[model samples]
Target: MAATARDIAAELRERIKSGALAPGKRLPGEPALVQEYGVAKETARRALTMLVTEGLAVRRKGSGTYVREFQPIKRVANRRLAPEGWGSGQSIWSADLNTRPMEVTKLRVDVESAPDNIALALNLTDGARTLVRDRVYVVEGEPVQSATSYLPADLVRGSAIEQEDTGPGGVYARLEELGAKPVRFVEEVRARMPAPDEVERLHIAEGTPVVEIFRTAFTDEGTPVEVNRMLLDASAYVMEYHVTS
Candidate 1:
């Protein structure tokens, strides 16, 4: 009886968790695993692949698999969305970053016809136009999330929200300046296998899933002001929400 890939992967997982294999350290390659476990090369490869698929390891082309080095970001939903955080010239994202630096890349702002769901979320009629802002969020040079925000074009057309850089508290602040300040939010979240573009954009491993979030922001009058769709690398985030009754 020979050890299966799962057996080897399990052992390796424990070793990684126990810090025997430090982050960025290469794991035993196929040949080494083959000899150590007395298993076929395919079995050894599958073992390594399992670790990669689980997000515990990464395969480097022309190199060997290494323990994943990127630290997971803690996303605090309630704190980040609280108006107090963003209303006083502070960015809502600051709650999540602490001292860590997160960069926005590939930012694009355009006016387009809203998608059906987005239009509905914003209480717009069919084919309503929106100001679409799209960007990728990167930490330590690794892309961890992508987001697209849709705001009613007529409402934001002349506002700072139409710019690539929404100053100070970001879009919410701009909306407030325009008398459409967001006072409440609702978020819907789901996990699913990554689409091809998401895999490329987030640099996610095969078999890795993504978390999709749709957040709708409304003003005190309960009029929807913005709809934001975010796709997050599941391996790169630990979502936290504060709840109260």
Candidate 2:
């Protein structure tokens, strides 16, 4: 009896999870898989494609397919903001704050027609072409957060700060560098099951959840400079907020 493509793909996925096939390791060619699995070329190809679609592996245009490294996902609990200077005074997670480099791994400034929700958030005319920035925040060589920010293009197109990479200092810091200090930020957070892609990118295990954080930053004049939606691996971070009566 011949094994099905699903059977082969499932076995390969388990091998990846078990570390038998290490991350960044190149997979054998189709011929090799066909020979080993006793499957036809088409069946082997289908199995490999399944792995790629599932994010367990990637196939580069000129390069062979390689396994992707597994990342540790974290669960974050919302906590009261550290009293003035608390974060600077205390050792929280032993994370190398000084060594962690902030980089803008992605930036897109295209004029995107605003969605209903986004238009309302940015106070834009319906169907207006807004400036949308898709950015990934990496710390210590790992992606810690992914965000998509929306702004009115006319408000920021002339600023170099919008186009340049702001290292170690996220958008907030960058805004300050441009002399538009972010005086306050409002955040709304919620948790949900990880999407298939999010699970793979965040390396979340089965049944683990993800955190969705929506933030709006405003200047002293109460002008909304940015509206950002961040997807965080819930298991990876703790949200801290400050409150006073």
Candidate 3:
């Protein structure tokens, strides 16, 4: 019997898993695969496509298919949301990332009506506009996540939260100063295929999915202070939550 494309793909998958095919190393081009595997062009193409769909390889336009360089960042729920992490003076990101670099590639502040879901979470009445803070987070020069925060327009009208930097500890710190500090948080996470815009913004490879996180911040009095929606590249993060009894 002839060696099927599945056989070729299985062999290549093992090579990638065993580190024989290092990240960034180009894979065999279609012609090369056909010649080496003695398979038809269609079979060779299917083999390569299989690898890509499995996230083991990435296809680049004008370049070629190569092993993926996936450096997954950990998103630790407890540590990142602790008061000491962002309420004091440290950035929440400091709780999870090591010495690797992370930056905000884009920042946009505006006043807009909250989306239906966001409005419900923030307890905003109909037609009420909120102050929106949107930012794109990059790690190691690669786009990883984008977050948009919604705060009551009246509550943060003149505060530094309206500014680009949001000061040392960010919005959480400002909320503290306003006597509406975030005392509790609820977060929900969901995953699905990336949207067209999300793929372009994050520069994600084809067949990669995205994780969506919705978080609501509340004051001790049970008043919701902020609602945040975050979209993350699934290939670049490990989401973890610690529960205490």
RMSD (Å) of each candidate, 1 decimal: 1.3, 8.2, 2.2
Q: In candidate 3, list every pair of residues with a backbone clash.
A: none
Q: What are the per-residue Cα lDDT tens digits for candidate 2 across 145-194?
A: 67788877766666643664433344555555565656766888888887
| Backbone clashes (count) for model 3 | 0
Cα TM-score of candidate 2: 0.54
Candidate 1 to native Cα RMSD, angstroms: 1.3
List the candidate 3 regions with Cα displacement exceeding 4 Å: 1-10, 53-55
* Candidate with best TM-score: 1
- Show model 1 residue runs off by greater than 4 Å: none
lDDT of 3 by residue, 1-245 (tens): 66688888898899998999999899998899889888899998888888876667878888888997866688899989899878678888988786778899788999998888878888989988999999899988789899999999989989999999888898999999999999899988999998898899888777778999889999999999999999988877888888889
Which model scores highest in lDDT? 1
TM-scores for every predicted model: 0.96, 0.54, 0.89
Q: List the residue pairs that clash in candidate 1.
A: none
Report the number of clashing residue pairs per model. Answer: 0, 10, 0
lDDT of 1: 0.92
Q: What is the TM-score (0 to 1) of candidate 3?
A: 0.89
